[model samples]
Target: MTDVTEEFRLNLAHIDGPLAIATLTGDLDLHTAPGLRTGALEWIGQGHHHLILDLRGVGFCDSSGLSALIGVWHSAKQAGGALELAAAPDRLTRMLTLTGLDSLLTVHPTAQDVLSTHRPTADA
Candidate 1:
C-alpha cells in the first residue's frame, strides 16, 4: 500500500478571528482524507470555525476526498461555522459540480479573494 502522508501535505496558512485558511497539497484520497478531516475539525474545535481550504496546491482528489470535504463542511456547520473552497482545480470543480456539492459549498477564485470579502462580525 502507498503511504499517502508522504505525498500529501496540509498546512494552516493563516488564521484571523474565526477564520482559518489551510493549504492542501498533493493527492487527496482514501488514506489522506481522514487526516484532512481530523486536522480541520481540530481547528474548529479550537475556535476557528470558518474555514477556507486552499486547493491550489492539490494535484488530485478522489471520491473519498470529496466525501472528506463534505464531512468537514457538515462538521463546520454543526459548530456554527462554514467551509469554503479556494482555487479548486478544474477537475475537482467538475467533480464537485457532478456530485452536486458545488451548490452546497462556496468556491472562490483564490484564498486572497475569500479573505478580502470576509467581514468578521463583532460577535465573532
Candidate 2:
C-alpha cells in the first residue's frame, strides 16, 4: 500500500463570496487526518468566516477523521464562523448518519447546494 501521507491531497480555494473551499481527496484516516486539521486552522487563521470541505473525491474516513472534522467545526464556531461538508460520498454520508453527526454537521449534496442556500447577511 502507498504511504497514507502520499495518498491524501487537500486543495484550497476561495469562492466568489466569503467562503473558502477545501477540496479533499483520498483516504481520511489516522495517517491523513492531521492534514485536514492543519488546513482548517490555516484557513481560520487567515480570517475565513465560512469553509466548505468538499469531499467528492474522498474514498474513506475513519474515526480519527471524524474527530478532526468535529474539531474543525468547533474551531469555526469559536471563530464566529461555520464549517460545512459538500459532495460527500455515500459511504461517508452513511457514516455520519450512523454516528448521529449528521445533525451537527451541515452537509449538502453539492458545494453549489450550500452556496445557493447560504446568502450573506446585509451586514456582510
TM-score of each predicted structure versus truth? 0.92, 0.88
Q: Candidate 2 residues 43-112, lDDT tens each?
A: 8877775888999989888888999999999998888788999998888788899989999887899888
Total backbone collisions, model 2: 0
Candidate 2 minimal-lDDT segment of 10 residues: 115-124
For each candidate, the alpha-carbon lDDT, in order, equals 0.89, 0.84
- In Å, residue 75's CA in model 2 sits off its true spot by 0.4
Give me the candidate number with maximum TM-score. 1
Compared with the true structure, what per-residue lDDT tens digits does model 1 show for residues 74-96?
99999888899999988999998
Q: After aligning candidate 2 to the native by TM-score, how far in Å is the CA of 8 from where it should be?
A: 0.7
Worst 10 residues of 1 by lDDT: 1-10
